[model samples]
Target: MSIRHITLAALATLAAAQSASAYELDYSIDLLVPAAWPTSVVLLNVNPSDWASSTRRGAIEDAADAFLLNPSWFFIEPLEDDDSSIGPNNENELTFTSNSALLCGSSACTHLWYSGTDIVEADIYIKNDTYSVGNTKSDNLAYAGSYRSLQTLILHELGHMAGLMDEDGNYSVMGQDWNVLHAGSTDVSPYLDADSGAGLRELYGTRVGFADLSVSHWGYGGSSGGFSTHERNIVEDTSGVEPWHTTIGGEPYYVLGAGEIYRFEATLENKSDTAYTVDVSIVISPDPIITGADTELVRIPGIALSPGPTEVWLPALVPEGTTGLYYIGAIIDAGGDVPEWDETNNGQYLVAAFSW
Candidate 1:
């Protein structure tokens, strides 16, 4: 959210004016009312003529996609029926404004104009004159120690338009401190962060059973004789074990040696309309032995998966002290942040033949 001009004495006057109005929601005061109903899909009209660079338009689309990735009921649709004009008649408009230099410097403003108690339409205005369009180093940066990008600012403002408030005294896109936010530029990948994404999910709805998780490959002790055998769902194969080997989708599991580094490869397929952040973990348990404590070998951090396939690799070393047949399992969404439609299908396990 951006700053506004409000004098100490002006507060009282504004309160009085709001009380006199017939509308239940006073536009003068800041509130958390949504621009549209939860069931309704809102339309946003981007003024294509305003941006000199095409990247800005792509940035706007990317910002919209970010919100759509969340489990929120609020949805945005671009008005493409009439490509000639952005909008001036009915749809909500997102346009550049050069006249709001007093309210903010190179920041964005969202005007939620209401008719009586219902919000008829809202407008998003960007400070095109104060901010650089394509340049990474914005001359008129808003916060002191922050890397403020135009796309990030637009995403924040869009969050506001979708009936979200600033998580003041916290770190989020809605927070006033822009220094904590990140833009998908250079090494940074665009994300809504945890807090903001959770808030949005709470408001709309949650997604469940949205991803298909699988371990594509697993192996220990480099390939023996420069040959590798891989399978999908096998317990153990101990025939002709020659030091080390690799497997590619084989049903029978290959032999794993003690004190050797093993590689686990897995892939996740997002079945939902939006992206997902998944927590992946590998568990090694007594399989052929079936009598020991299950040891969690490693846990990979949350990996962002778009509405498609994403691959991850985890390298783990087997302790030299342990000597037993174990089964390796790959678990997805270990924290349960994502509501899977099918909880039973979240993990895949395979039995392994081991040599100590």
Candidate 2:
């Protein structure tokens, strides 16, 4: 997923803050806590009259989708004390100054007063217009927290709630991998990639909560050609080979031939809310005609993927010295059961032939 931010552009939209960062663009953040439960944390959700005009619902929708994608880490709850009365956009206007955490910067983040004294009285904000904060009370999208497939603006704001600032934290959702993390404009939405989602799963999955084991697969017709043929770079789908699903418990049975480059593809859907470690492998079938042993194998790295559609690239993976039919498989590493335990090997698999 590509994270799109727009801080340098908030000017045209009329989003202006009273802080020293009045001219920067927009930015946003996410807070992961685990187990789909939102604690009694407090933060401000401001629209400032023209909010609907300046911000697109889609940006908020994407953020909501992320929260729904993983519920264990976040839950949108109500404010325990709105009675304290903090001014709408002032760094100093406030209550909840005890257990609360503030997300501010530019015009988007007006100010924050927290009640959690230990959180450290530090002032951190999105620094631009393109940034966003959590919705301890944001009711913009009613469809959030239903499923990962759904979207939410609150989650985007929570990222900000969790210090998703300027992309500098070690495991921050606001990290610099995005080109727009700088303090130059007002960006309404930014996205965290599949890899980042996985990282967050690992980071908050344990501390927050775990999810059920689920799976989804999508593939086109045989090598000869069908629905998704062109998408696979499958120049010509073999006429006789029909479509097939890999065994959930069997050892991989795919092969690759010498001098031939193979392209392996698969469609995956994250059935559960937690993150997933999706990977693929190319196995060489040890044949008497082939000189070397099948011992040499090609495996995918720590993919760090989430529960969604992802394509694994295996270019020219097999060396020329070896020639034979092989099986290629996508594996979902052990550990699907609760308590973070490993499960029997479960994944998507396919077979193919490589040639000179």
Candidate 3:
């Protein structure tokens, strides 16, 4: 059964607002109902002969495999080839299409058939004639010209099948801009960012037997660019500048002036089925690893974190006359309120150069 559809303009507007956190779940036309696959494992049928070349088929397979890298509870497996069609025939199929109408002037599109909130089928169709599809590792700039990365496109479409909406502004695999797959565009892995993984985990659940509450990283987002955790000086133009001011021995460092406040964001991941009301502490330490023994700068308490990823924007204030090269970091569950499988990963810190 086909559910009602939302207008693209309304969807784009909603996506823009949620871009601060970098992931959105697909909703019905009225935005009243959200949809996701009911099961943890989704099976798809593929035909090797559907592609003109073996590499093309390999690209599709590679895309599906990329999802396995995430900590989400979902799994995608390939079934034996059968006479599959690109419709709501109870078959999830990945194939090519030359129909311009189906493509909608884009390189590819995914159609999902859902009953109420449960997605029963999904069909991914790639425009075989309008674009040249291949592996992105060979050439990421292919999108700049005529070629497109089949793997990247499929990876994004699979996100749709998993009930993730198209994300804008954030550097995500589900980004509307295909150039995000290009090399050197984003610091995070191109296959799946923390945002996408967090979305998946939110939809389904965290993998069984894995309970981790971690500070994924500290970064900032800009109007022109996506979130980044790299080290770079804060300048007038924040377009390409990273969150930290410098880096030492591969560790990020934030240089702060006395009595100055800086705004930054952190990605927190809850790899457990239970939601937690936790506290996040911003601390300063002489050592690279942050701990409760360090000087506490600020404590953000009572953060409601559901399963998956949550992005929080925080302010860091440099105390008067504070001068030293220390580590400025965030410790999730700083009060140890939540029991996790690995407590060591809850803290993530960056070097801080505090100058008077």
Which candidate number maximizes TM-score?
A: 3
- Give the least accurate 10-residue stretch of model 2, judged by summed lDDT: 14-23
Tens digits of lDDT, candidate 2, 1-356: 01111211111111011111101112222233222112323333323222243343333444545444342353322222323333433322212122223443122342323443212112222322332232211221211211111112233334444333232212122332221110101111233322234434433453345443221122222222111121121211223232333322111233334544444443333324556653333344433111122332444434444442243333224456765444344334323323322122133333444443
Point out the higher-scoring one by lDDT: 1 or 2. 1
Clashes of each: 14, 81, 0
Residue range with the least summed lDDT across 10 consecutive positions in model 1: 14-23
Tens digits of lDDT, candidate 1, 186-212: 122233433455455555565543333
- TM-score (C-alpha) between model 1 and the true structure: 0.45
Greater lDDT among 2 and 3 belongs to 3
Over the stretch 1-356, how does candidate 3's per-residue lDDT look in tens digits? Answer: 01111221111111112234557788773376568888999987774466435666666666777666565778787554567455778888877777877776677888888788889998877777532344332343322344456666778888888898876545456764344331221122235445677788778876766556776442223334322222121211123234346544333356666665554456666656667888787777776566788787777667777665566654456567788776567788988887676676666653345564
- Alpha carbon lDDT of residue 206, candidate 2? 31
Question: CA shift at 168, candidate 2, in angstroms?
Answer: 4.2
Q: After superposition, how far is residue 346 of candidate 3 from its true place, in Å?
A: 16
Ranking by lDDT: 3, 1, 2
- Assess every candidate by TM-score: 0.45, 0.33, 0.53
Q: Candidates 2 and 3: which is better by TM-score?
A: 3
lDDT of 3 at 212: 64
